[model samples]
Target: MKISPSELISVLAQFNPWWRGGHIAGLPAWKRAAWHELNQWVTQPPVHRAVLLSGARQVGKTTLLLQCIEDLLQQGVPAANILYVTFDHPMLKLGGIDAVLAAWREREPRAEGIEYLFLDEAQFIRDWGTWVKHQIDFVKDRRIVFTGSATPLLEADQESGVGRWHAIRITTLSFYEYLHIKQLALPELPPLRSLRHLFDWTAPDFYRVTELAAPYTGHFHEYLVRGGFPQTAQIESVAQAQRLLREDIIDKVLKRDMTALFGVRRILDLEHTFLYLCMHDGGLLDMTDLCSNLQVKRPTAQHFIELLEATHLIYRLPPFGYGKDVLRARYKVYLADAAISSAVLLKGKNILDDPTALGVATETAVFRHLFARYYAQQVRFTYWRGKQEREVDVVAEVGGQIVPFEVKYRTQHTGVRELKGLMELCQQKNISRGYVVTKALDDFGLLAGTPEGINIMRLPAPLLCYWMGEAELHGVVE
Candidate 1:
């Protein structure tokens, strides 16, 4: 059942409606925060490398590609010169990339100038990395951009694609991006260059910022439960949104992509492991206990975890320390989005009523923001555990400086005793500043009567996420 060139051209025509003199429809009016970087790379690449836009399923990678096509069209690029095709489509999969290209060249022989190829879900193509490398090395006046749902696109061909392509990860929406996607109206605050910039602010300045951020506080719990997927951001019903997330994001990755890409045979075992991680999200992982409980071997459980991470369903954080200390530590596990936990567990809006669940979800959200903000800067995120079981939730290593953050998202007053881990880490590391994310807006300020030299800011979780998201959008860093 081979697809002919004509049949492939028919499919391509359907995908690329602009070739028929129709506009690219269904484009989102508001672009993602990643759009700026991606657009720049596509239009004016710093290097002559192709762009690989990678992320989990349903994070709007396809939409971003379509938006890029629209931008190219607006710039007076001939519609036929811009090709858009997805290997996910069965027809395209049958024909492969070669057939599609052959058909395009045959049909558009007279077309000239730069050609843009937008390939979606490119991992389905066999030896895609080598194909792209050949194109980059041999082809001229051709700019290629591809999207992948899994990291195999990266892991499988790192050596070959070392300098041939630039990878840009499109994570689940940040709180600020989520708010914009939801079209919520709120007051505009002054730009924040970095989280560290807040430490230098006076009491009046901090309060004024917090007051301006008051409207965002009400949406924090919602964002945590709904997660950051653009599709679910505007869904009014919590149950419906979680249902979509579970079916679209979790189920597809576990059932289909794992089997197709990674040759995973025991989907039930993978599902069980993911559920266990959801229950213990933001907690340290014990593979022994997990294997014993799931009645699986150590290697099998380890394989499942790796496959999950590859699919971008989970993130593993190693403990922060030097040499053997880091190697000997058990890693902490977190779902890419807090809403994944909520969706898988069917926690819905009730998650807010459960304080323990609320705390774990908040910590997951905080880590997501931190990872999104600093991943490009080569920041290493790890947790710290000390004697008597004192642990800082997240310890970020930026340029050899240790910045510790602890989450205290409880309604009660946060006393100095509660910030023991952050304070201890700051003192031991001689770190001048740290942050304790709290639940109340009134908790926003500097900790008083401290250890003199060390300073800790008690910021609300909403404000922290919002500001971090905003700062990342603006490419603001210290």
Candidate 2:
């Protein structure tokens, strides 16, 4: 069915209320960390390339775009020059980009100056990459910003968008952003430059920081269950929030987006694979066991895993080693967010009661923070396992320096003996510092008298996450 130009223009006008002398309303003033990165690209792009924001659904991508539009209006930019349209709308979906733009131009023929176009859910448009590339190459004095819930821009249609667009991933809110959104009045502490700087902190510094962050302890557990999605983070009821997360974020990606974008025919198999990952979050992947338990072939299970990762539902961490050894080692998987596992497995506040479950969630949270913090630096994140089944949870290779972190989120006090994996890795690699994430606030300090003069700092998981989140928000470098 061919859609008429008048029909498309009506949809565009509704989306861009400012075009009709109205304003964007009912949006929060606060912004995510990605806002800083995005603002730079929109206002003063270093190069003349379009910007693409990609992430899982309900991560507030649309909200961020709306915020940008509001800012531009305030700057006194002509409202007609800006076009905000989302393909999610059925009418717009029927009217492809060319038809929509033609309608827009028909309504406003003054296309003489720079035009800013914000396209939402652009993956629905067929050959969107080629279309965007053509705009970048042929069109002059025009800027384009698009958003997608999937990674089609980088995967299937990447060749067309190779150098035409800059990709920025918008992740779930961090603990710091979560606190701000919840409007918690916890006292702010001095910023710690980076995770590496904690090694140089004195005894008093550690004690002072821990005391300052004590007020956050009561809320950290709730944050774990609620997760970082802005929409669900503020819901008063934890169960209701988790339910919404499952329905809105998890289910949409698994049931609808997977089938539409990736040709996933066996939805049951994909759902079961995700559920299994949730049950064993932060565990090694055993392909044979997973295939047998799911009653699917090896290739089918592998394809499901790939689809999950592509949709940003899970993260896969390879083992730390050279070529052949790394190839043979099993990959450890973690949900993109801790709250996801909790939502899927129906673990609410009761999750905190189960130490084992709590530990897994905490480790998953820690990995997410580390991944977000160092991802921009191109740092390689992998786990290490030695003889006797000793293992380090996360080993970050930064500028050829190996920093090992082991999560021991337990009530009892941890000694050097329990951190055998961290200690052994430090000794073998001649690294001077390591970290152990603990459960109790009182367990925050350095473990002295270790072999090879290694300094292992035991930090509470909540405080560590808070500081890491803070550092990321501030863009503090080591």
Clashes of each: 0, 0
- lDDT per residue (tens digit) for residues 1-478 in model 1: 8888888888888888888799877778988878888999989888788898888998889999999999999999988799998999999988999999999877666377799999999999989878888989888689999998547886778777888988888889999999888888898877778777788888899789878888877798999988899888888988889999999888999999998888888999999999999889999999999999999999999889988887788899999887987887799998899898878988798889999999999999999999999888899999998767889999999997888999999998677899777777887889898889999888888888679898888989998898889887777767
- Tens-digit lDDT track for model 2 on 401-474? 89898999998988988888888788888888889999888788887668868888888888888888887777
Q: Which candidate is the best by lDDT?
A: 1
Off by over 4 Å in 1: none
Residue 137 in candidate 2, Cα distance off native in Å: 1.7
Per-prediction TM-score, please? 0.98, 0.97
lDDT of 2 at 138: 93
Span of 10 residues, lowest total lDDT, candidate 2? 149-158
Clashing pairs in 1: none
Model 1 gets an lDDT of: 0.88
**Model 1 alpha-carbon miss at residue 232, Å:** 0.6
TM-score of 1: 0.98
